[model samples]
Target chain A: MANSASGESIIRRFITIISAFDDKHTSMSVAELGRRTGLPVTTTYRLVDELLLERLLERDPKGNIQLGTRMWELASRGSKTLGLREAALPFMEDVQSVVQHSTTLGVLDSDEVLYIERLGSTSTIVDITKIAGRLPVHATSSGMVLLAHSPSAYQDMILSRPLTKYTETTLTDPAALRRHLAEIRQRGFAAMPGVIVPESSGIAVPVYGSDSTVVAALSVVVPRDEENTAARVPVLMTAARGISRALGWRGKLKGTLRQSH
Target chain B: MANSASGESIIRRFITIISAFDDKHTSMSVAELGRRTGLPVTTTYRLVDELLLERLLERDPKGNIQLGTRMWELASRGSKTLGLREAALPFMEDVQSVVQHSTTLGVLDSDEVLYIERLGSTSTIVDITKIAGRLPVHATSSGMVLLAHSPSAYQDMILSRPLTKYTETTLTDPAALRRHLAEIRQRGFAAMPGVIVPESSGIAVPVYGSDSTVVAALSVVVPRDEENTAARVPVLMTAARGISRALGWRGKLKGTLRQSH
Candidate 1:
C-alpha cells in the first residue's frame, strides 16, 4: 500500500495536497500549502518537488505553486463531465438568453449538488452558484429536483440527517421535506423562492440520460420578486428536454410522460 | 525523489497512467492500461490500487477502470482555465449566435493551441476542434493570433522547426509565416482559409488578460467557400474585446489602439 511512517498511503497524502486548493485559494507558498494540508515540511517539499517535475503542479509568476494546465488536460480529456457539459451548453445558452438570468446545470454527487456548468449575467444578479461549486442537497432547487428523482431509500437516508436552514423559508423538517419532494416529482419540476438566498429564486427540471435515468438538473436563478417566475418553467422544461435528447434519452419522462418528438 | 525501480519517479508513473486516457480511450482493463502506458503489469496493478483507494480512479459497473470525478474536481476547482472560460463564455455565445458557426476560445499551451471553450452548430461544419484538443500552432487561426502577440524570440523558435503541412494552404516556410504574423499583428486579426482542413476556414482575434497580455484567441470556423467570412471579423473582435474587458484589461492592445468601450 506504500504507507508512510504515519500509516497513511501516499495516495491519501496526495489527495490532501490537491484538496488544499480551491477557487478562493488557487495558489499558495509551499509552506502555506504544507500548513493547509497538515503534512510534515519534509514530506510536503518532497512530494511537491515530484509533482512539479511531472508538471501536475506549476510555479506561478510569483513563484507560488498552483494547478497546472497539464493536470486539467489530463483530468478533462476523458471525463464524463466534459461530455455532459458539451451536451448541455447549447441548451443552457437558450435558457439563459430567454430567462435573462443565471442558468446552471447541476448533478447529485456524493450527496451534494455539484454545479457542472453555469451561464448568465455575472454581476447583475445575487446568484452564488459557480461551476465546480457545491451546495447542500436540501437548500437549492437543483438539489431538490435531483433528490426527487433519486431512489426512495437514498432520499430517506439523506433526509434522515439534519439539514441546514439557509433562509427562513428553507424546509428542514423531514416530513415536510418528503411531502415537498413528492410535490416536486408530481409537478415535473422544482421551484424554490428564497430557499438559499432571500433575493433569488431557483427553478429546475430533471435532465435524463440514454438509460432513462435522471442525470442532471437544468435550472435558472431569477429575482425572487419576479411574479412571472412560473412562466419561465416552460422554457426551462423545453431546454431540459433538448439536453436530455442530446444525451440520447428516448423514453418518456417518469412523471410527465412527455416525449421530445 | 521516490524513484521507482525503473529510475522514474512515482509522480511520473502517475502521470503516465492518467495520460493513457483521452477523449477516445476513456476506460480499459488494467492490462490494457499497462499496455497503453508502457508500464509493467505489476506496477500498473499496484499503482491503480493506490489510485482507486484515493478515488482518483474508479471502476465502472462493467469492471473497467476510468478517470474519477474526484480527479476532475481537483483539477478544475482551482484551474486558471475555469476563470478564463467563465469570463469568455457569455461573449462567445453572442458571437456564436450571430455567426451561426462554431465559435471557440483557445489558449497557447506548450507551443500549441489548446481549445478551452467552444459553441455553435456542432454538426453543420467540418470543424476538427474540440474542448481539451490541441492543434499545431501554424495550422490554426487561433495559433496565428497567439503567435502574433508572443515575443519575437518565442515566435522565431517555433517557426525554426519543420512545420507540418496539414493542407495545401498551411504555411510551412518560416519567412512566409513570419510575414503572415506581421500582417496579423497589424490588422488585429488572423483569417486562414482551409489551412488545416479543406472544407472549412478559421478567423481569430486575440483576447487580453488583466496585465494587458494576449492570453487567448477567440475564433469562429466557417465554410471555406464563404466569401462573407471577412464580414464576421468585426463580431469576433467585438466579442474578444468584451472578454478582454471582463478579464480586467485596460491598456491599449500592443498593435491596435482600439478599446472595448
Candidate 2:
C-alpha cells in the first residue's frame, strides 16, 4: 500500500463523497458532491468521472450522479443482510399478509434499532422506518426488544447518551426506560404506545440466534386504539422463530436481528 | 474545477478500491485490497482506516473489514431500488410462493442484467446468480427480456461487443442472438432453457416503468424437467404487470416481452 499522505487523503475524500448520497440526497451535481465531501471541486469531478468509469456511481441522462447498480452490487452481495433477509422474507410476508400492518425486523446497531426488513399493506399504519434505516432504540418497540435483550453495555451507552424526544410519551427518563426494558424481557415483547408517534403502538419481540443471543427484533406497528393487534403476537413470534430456525439458531434462543447481527 | 492530475489520479484509485469488493470477494486484507486495487499497500491501509473511522467499513473479530451498515444505509435509503423493490416485492413473493424456487428482479446495467433482489427457496434451481450480481444479456432470461424490449442503441452496443458464452446453449452468434431476442419480443417472454446451466431453466418477463419502457425483468429459476413451470409465466406476467402499474405504466397492457409496433 502507498504511504503517500496524498493517496490516503484522496481515499478519505472519496468515502465522504460516497457517504454524501444518503436517503435525502441520492443524486448530486459534481459541485454539490465536492461541497458535501469538502473536497476541491476539481478533485470531486475527477473522482466522479473515475467512479462513473468503474460503474460504481452512475450519471443519469440528466447528468446527476447516483449510487450505481455496480456500487450496490459490490456492497450488497454475499452480505449478512442478504442472507438474513432471505430467511426472514417468507415469515415477514406471512406476518404482513395477516396483520396488514408494518411488520419489521431490526437489530441493535450503535444502540439504535437498525431496521433490516419491513413490509406492510398500503392501508396499514404509516411507518417512518425503511430497510437499512435506523430509529432510536428507546423510542420504538423494535428498539426496545433489541435494547432489552442486548448487553448492559449497550443500554448504558444509550442511557448515558442524549435521548432525542419524538413524542410526549417517549420514555426519556433512563430509570423509566430501564424498567420498561426489563418489563419487555419479562413479557417476551415490548408494547410501546405513543412513543414514536401519536395514536400508534409498536409491539416487538426478540429474535434469537444460534448462540441464544438476542440478535434481532421482530415487530409490528399498529394503531394505538386497536386492541385486536394483540392476536398478531403469536403469529409474529412464530415467524421470528421460523427465521431463527432457518439461520440454524436452535438454542434456548434469545433473539437475532435478521441482518448485521 | 481545477484540472489537477494529482486529484484525478487519487479519485481513480478510490473507485478502484471500492470496486474491489464484490460477490466473490466480500472481505480482504489491506494487502490483498492493495493488490486488487493496484494501489500501494500503505495507501489502501490508510484510506481503509479512514473509511473504518467513518463506519463505511467495519472490522470483524478477525480484524478484516467488511462492508458496513452505513454503506447499506446510504445505498438503500431513498434510492430507486427501494421504490422499485417495494413495487416488485409482492409480485416477486407471489411468484416465489407458488414457484418455490429462485425468484428475482433484475434491471439492465452496463449491457448486462444486474439482479437487485433474489428470493431463493430450498428446492430452488442451483445457480451462481446472487443478489447484486450480473449476468450477460444474451445468456440470461431476465437479461434477454430486458434487451429484447430495449432501444436499438443498446442492441447495437451489445452486438458490437463480443458476446461471451456462458454455456454451449448460449447464443454467441450475433445473428442467432438477434433472432433469439426478436423472438423473445414476439413471444412477450423469454424461455431460456439450458442457457446458463443444463439442469435449470429460466423464464422471464419484462417489467415496465413510468413511461411504459421495459425498465426491468422479473424472472424465476426452476428445474429443467418441470414442464409445469410454464404455468409460472402467467403468474410472472401478472406480477410484472402489477409492478409496472405501480411504477406508473398503464394501458390495455400486453403482458409480454415483445415490442409492439
Candidate 3:
C-alpha cells in the first residue's frame, strides 16, 4: 500500500504511469514519464524500478522505458477480450476480404466504444478507428449497435448525458437517439452515414455471446459516397453470426425471444 | 507500499494474483483466487478490492473476478508489441491464406519463444502455438530463426543450456545446433520437421525492425508429410519482408552487411 503524499494509492499511481503512454508515446525517459504522470520524480523512478525488475516494463537500447512483452502477455493471457477478439478475427478477415473496407470489432466500455481489433484496407476510406481507441457511443455505427442492445437503464444513462455533435447526422438529442436505437434494434443493424467523419460511413451488427446477449459490434467502414448498406449489412450480419457461433452462442433463447410487455 | 508480512513487495503480489489467471482459468472467486495465488485470504481480498476499484479486475454476474477490459486497454494502448503485431497481421493473413495452415508471429522473450499473434487454420496440422503462449527456443522453428540472427553471446548462452529433445529431430548438442543456426542464417529461413510435434513441421523467416535487427520470426505450421519447404519458404519470406518494411526496416544496413570476423 504505497500512498503518495498526495494521498493517492500505489495502484492509482501505477495506472497514471501506464496511462501516460499511448500509441503516439510508446516509450520515454523517466523524467518525461514523471512530467506526463505529474508524479514526483522519486516516486516515478521507484515505481519504474519495481516494474522493470518484474519485467512488466523494459528499457530500450536507448534506456527509454516502455511496456514489456510480459505486460502484454499478462494482460492478454486471461483476458475475456482475447476470447472475443480470437472468435471475431477470422470472420472479420472474411468480411474485410469481401467488403474491401476496414473491418473492426468493438465492445462498449466505460460509456464509449472501445475498438479491440481493426483490419485496415488499402482503400481511401477516411476511417479513424484504431485498436484500443475509443469513440463516443452516440456517433459510431458500432456504438449504436452496442447501445441498441444495452439494457434500458444504461441506455438512459448515456442518453441523458450531454452528447457531442461530431457530425450533422450524429444523434445527440435523447428522444431522437432513443428512436434511432429502437430502429437499429428492429433492423438488426446500424448504418450511419458520415456520423463521425464526413467522408466515411460505418455499418455494424451485433455479435452475441453464449447467453444470447450482444457482446460486441462487428463493423465495416466504407466511403460515404459508396454507402452500400444493402450489400454491406448482409456481409457484416453473416460474419457477426459466425463470430457469435464461435463464441458458443446457440442462436437465441426462447425466454429472451418472448416479447416484452 | 502495501507489502504483506511475508516480505513480498506489493507489485510482486499483484503479479502473483494476475499470474494465477490464464487462458485455462479466466475467472475465479475470491476464495479460489486466494488459493491459486497462495496469498493470504485477507491480502487477496484487499488487493482484489483495490484492483476492482481501479477497474483492473471486473466481477462477472456470478461474482467471479476476471481480467478487466481496462487492463487490456492500458497494456495495449502504448505497447510496442501492438505496432509489430499490426504490421505483421496483414502479411500473416496472406501467409495463412496461401499456406492454409497456422501462421504465427513470435519474438524472443526470456530465452523462450513467445508467440504474439497467431492466425489459426482449418487444417489438421497440430500447432501447439497460441497467442501469449511460450515454447522452448531449441524446439520451435520460430525460435531457431530468431536465435540464428541473435548476438553470438546469446546463441552461446542458449546452446549451453540443457536442451529438451522434444522429438527425434530436436537438436540437443550445442555444436550441432550451432551448425544448424549458421545454416539457417545463411539460408535466410529455418525449416524444422517434427522438431516439437511428431505430426507437423514448422518453417520460419526472420522479420526485421527499423534498426535492421531481427525483431521477430514469422512462421507457418504444416503437416509433416506435406512439408513443401520450397514453396512455403518463399511465401513466408515474402510476407516477412513486407512486415519488415511495414515496421520501417529499410533493408539491411551497409555496415551490418559487412561480414563479422
Candidate 4:
C-alpha cells in the first residue's frame, strides 16, 4: 500500500509546494506555500529551510522564495533544452537581425507553449510571452505550429477541451481551430493576426531535430498592419532549418532548403 | 536532538549526487552516484527516481543520469544569473568575436571559479572547464580575480591552508599568491601564463555590480605564445568593463577602457 496519507514522502510535498507557483504566481511566502500545498506551516518551514540550505530555493531581499541558481545549474548542465538552445542561437540571431521585430523560441510543454528564448527590440511589439513562461496551445502562432504537427491524441486533447480566447481572432471554437491548424500544416507555417494581441501578428515555423521530429518552434511578432507575412515565413523557415542542421537534422526540410545531393 | 541524520537529508544527498558530476564527469550511473555520494544502492535508486519524477534529473540514451532542463528552467526563470548572463551576452559575443578563444564569465563560488557562461570556438581550447564547473581559486585567472577582490578573511582562510598546484606556474606559495593578489589589485586585471595548462594563458578582469562590488571575473584563455598577451589584455579588460557597465557598474575601470568619460 502506498503511504499517501503518511508524511513519509516529503519529496512529493516539496514538489507540491513548488508547483503552486505557476506562470500566474512566481513568488510566494511560507504561509502561502503551506496553504497551497495543504501542509502544516511548521512542516513547510522545515522543508523550505532544507531546500534553502541545499540552495534549491532562494530568498529574495523581500524574503519571498524564488527558484535558486543551483537548481538551474543542475537542470541545464545536461538537458535537451541546452543543446537545442545552443544550436538555435546563431540562426535565431540571424532571424532577429533580418526580421528586426521579435524573434522567439517556443517548445510544447504540457499542451502549452513554453517560451525558452525571445529576442526583441524594446519598442518593436507588445510581446505577451516571457522566457520560461507559457501560453495556450490554440491561441498563439507558435502553439498552432506545434499543435498542427503534434500527435493525433494531443490534437484531440486540445480540440476536445474548452479553448480560451485571448482576443476576438483567437481560435476558441474547436472546429475553427482544426481548420486553422490544417491551413497551418498546408502552408508549413502559422500566421495569425490579432490572435493573442490586438496589434501584433505572429508568424511561426517548426524546427526539426536529428530525429526528424518537430522539436521546437521559431516565431516572430510583427505589427498587424505588416503585409509581408509571406516574406517573413521564408526567413523564419530558413532560420529553423539552420538551427535544425546545427542540431544534426540532415534531412532536407520540405520547401525550406535546396537539396545538396 | 537531531532525529534525522544528515545522510537522510535526501535533498542534501541529491545536491551532492548532482554536484559530483563536474567538467570531468557529466553523466553518472546509479552505482557511481552511490559510490560518490556514499549512499546505499537502494537509497541512490530511490532518490534518483524522485529526482526523475520531479524532472530534475534526466536519463541519457545510455541510461546514465544527467542534469535536466527543468533544473535550468527553475534556476534561470527568476535568478540573478539570468540577468547577469543576459547583460553580459552582447559584450561576451563581442569578446568572442575578437578573441576567438575561451571567453568565459565566472563568479565567486566559495573561493573557487564557478563559470556561469562560456562562449568560444569549439576547437580553440583544450581545457574543458564547463558551465557550473569549479576550478581552484589559485589555479585560474578568473579565480584569482575573484579571490583577490574577495573579503580579506576569505583570503586568510585560503592562504592559512595549503595552496594547490596544477602546473609548475601555479601559485602554490601563499606568500607569492598574496603578492600576486596585490598586483592584480594594482593592475585592475590578472594575467597568468601557463597556470592552468602548460600551453595556455588566462587573462581576467573584475566585473562589478550595481553596488560597486566585484561580483564576477571575465576571462579569456589564449595560447601561451606571449606574443598575443599584450594584445589580449586590453580586449579582456574592455569586455569586462562593458559587461560591468551593463551590470550597472558605474565606477571607472582603468587600463580596460580607452575612452575617458
TM-score against native, each model: 0.94, 0.88, 0.96, 0.84
Whole-structure CA lDDT of model 3:
0.89
Instruction: Report the lDDT tens digits of candidate 2 across residue range A194-258.
Output: 88888788888777766677778999998888976567678878888898888888746343332
Model 3 per-residue lDDT tens digits across residues A1-261: 545688888888888988998999999999999999999998899999999999999999999999999999999999999999998999999998988879999999989999999998545579889999999999999999999999999999899999999888877999999999998887788889989988888988899999888999999998899834667877887788799999999976442233211
Error of 3 at A117 (Å): 0.5
Which candidate's TM-score is highest?
3
Rank list by DockQ: 3, 1, 2, 4
lDDT by residue for model 1 over B17-43, one digit each (tens)?
A: 988888898889999999998888998
Model 4, B109-224: lDDT tens digits are 65567788878645777665676667888888898898888889999987888777778888888899999999898777888889878988888888888888888999888888
Query: What is the Cα-based TM-score of model 4?
Result: 0.84
By DockQ, is 2 or 3 better?
3
**Candidate DockQ scores, in order:** 0.74, 0.48, 0.84, 0.41
lDDT of 2 by residue, B1-261 (tens): 223334445555545666777656767777888887677666678778877886777776568777777677666764677778888987888888888888899999887888888887645467767778788888899998998888888898988888877677888888888999888887788888888887888999988888778889999998888877667788888888899998898745443433222
What ranges in model 3 sit over 4 Å off?
Answer: A253-261, B253-261
lDDT of 1 by residue, A143-208 (tens): 999999999998988999989999999999999999999988888888999999999999999999
Question: If both were scored by lDDT, which would come out higher, candidate 3 or candidate 4?
Answer: 3
Candidates 2 and 3, the one with greater lDDT: 3
Better of 1 and 3 by TM-score: 3
Candidate 4, residue B245: lDDT: 86
- Colliding pairs, model 3: A1-B1, A1-B2, A2-B1
Better TM-score candidate (2, 3): 3
